[model samples]
Target: MTDAMTLDSYLAAGGVLTNPTNVPPRYRAELMKLMATFVDSELAGAAGFADVINQGPGIKERIAAAKIVLEKTDHADRVLKIMGEFGADTDRYATHHPWTARLDRKADIGATRSEHDMRLAVFNYPISGWTDAVVMNLLMSRAVAEQLAEFSTVSYQPLAEAFRQIAPIEAHHGELALEGAVKLVENGASQDMQDAVDYWWPRVAVSFGRDDPNRFEHLRSLGLRHSTNAALRERWARSADEALKQLGLKSPS
Candidate 1:
C-alpha cells in the first residue's frame, strides 16, 4: 500500500483512510465525469437568470432575485474545486462537457427551460422561473440536499468538507426558494403551481441516477455515496408535496 492517500483511497477506506494524494484512474474518471456534469449543469442554470434579468421586462425585485442565480453558479465553482482536487482535468471538463446553460438554449420543447418573462415561455413547464420553473428546481435541490448531507460523512476529508460547506447554504436556498414560491403565488404562478407540481412529480421520481448495480458498489465501497439515489428521490417527492401544500399549491388534477 502506498503511504500517500489519494481521493480514491480516502473514499474507499470507509472512514479507514484520510489523506489527499493521487486519485486512482477509474475513480478519477467517475469523479471527473460527475463534477464536469455538475459544473456544466450549474453554469447553464445560471445563464437563465441573466436571460431574465437582462432582456426581459425589468422588475425592481429582480435585483435580489438575480442574486440566487449568481450564488448557484458560485456553488458550481466550489464544487468544481472539490472535483479538481481529485485530479480532474479542468481543461477537459471545461471544454468537452456541455454546461446546463447550453441545455437551456435548446430548441426542443421539452428541452426548453423557463424564463423570467412569462410571455416568451410556457408558464407551467416546471422550469421557467418567471413562469413556474423555479419551484421545480427548488424542490429538486432540496431533495439533493438530503443526499449531500449524508455525503458530508464521506471518509474523504475534503469531500466531506465540500458537502458540509454546501449543505448549510442549502438551508438558505430552501428558504429563499420557498420565498420565491411565495412570491410566485402572489405574482402569477398561483394557479400554475399545480401544473408545476404535476409535471415535476414524475420527473423527480425518475431523475435519481442510473440503476446499474455496479455503480453503487464503487461508490459505497469507496464511502462516497452514503445515500442512494432512490432514497433521495423519494425524500424529494415528499418534501415537494409538503412544500406545495404549504405554498397553497397542488399538483394538477
Candidate 2:
C-alpha cells in the first residue's frame, strides 16, 4: 500500500531492512522480484480456472471474484517490479508443489467440473466449492496466504520486506474466500456442511509438502523459509479444527 505502489502502477512499497545478518544482502532484491513473479503467476493461475471465467452462482459474485483476482495479479506485478529495483531476478522456477499436482490430476480436477463427472473421478466426490470456485478459493487461497504471512517475515531481507507489503493484500484475498465459504454454509443443508468438511479435511492434512529434502526445513535453514513443514501442519490442524466443528463436522482424529 505504499505510494506509487498501491496497485496503481504495480509497484510495491519499500521498507527498511535491519536484518542483514540472516538474509543475504544480494538475495534481498532478487527474492522480492521472484516473490512478485510467484504472486503474479498465482493470480494468473486463479484466473485460468474454468469456474472463474464462466458465470457462477451469480453475477455479483463473479464480478467480485474477478476484481479480486485482478487486484492480486496487479499487486504481484507491483512487488515484482519493486524487487527488480532491489536487484532480484524475475526468472521463473518450476514448482514441485504437490497440492497443485493433486488438484490438476484427472481424478482430482479442481472445483468446476460437472457434478456427475466430478463424483465419478474425484475421490472426494464433492469439492465443496466447485460450483462457485469461491469455496475452493476460500479454502485453498487462505491456506496459501496464511503460510505467506509468516514467510513474508523470512530471514531473507528483500523477500521479507516485500512480504510485509504483500501479506496484507493476500490477507484481504484470503478473507474474501472465507466470506464466500460462510455464504456457502449460510443456507447450506447439514449434509452439505458435512460434505464440505469431509472434502477439505483429508486434503488439508496432506497440504504441507512432499517428503523431499527440498522442503520447508531446508528452506528454513537457509533463511528462505521461516517455519518447518511439520510445525506448519500442526498449526494448520489447530486452525482447521474450530472451523470444522462450527459446521457440525468432525475434525480428523
TM-scores for all candidates: the values are 0.73, 0.60
CA lDDT of every candidate: 0.58, 0.51
Candidate 2: residue pairs that collide? 10-78, 28-158, 29-88, 30-88, 111-130
Weakest 10 consecutive residues, lDDT, candidate 2? 116-125
**In candidate 2, what are the lDDT values of residues 123-201, reduced to their tens digit?**
2322324333554454455456656766676554665676677777767765766565566667664466555555655
How far is each candidate from the true structure, as Cα RMSD in Å? 6.3, 10.5
- CA displacement after TM-score superposition, residue 164 of candidate 1 (Å): 1.2
- Residues 74-149, candidate 1: write the lDDT tens digits: 8777877777666556555444533332223223343233342111122122245454445655665676577567
- For model 1, the superposed segments whose C-alpha errors exceed 4 Å read 1-13, 16-22, 54-60, 86-126, 251-253
Model 1 lDDT, residue 115, Cα:
44
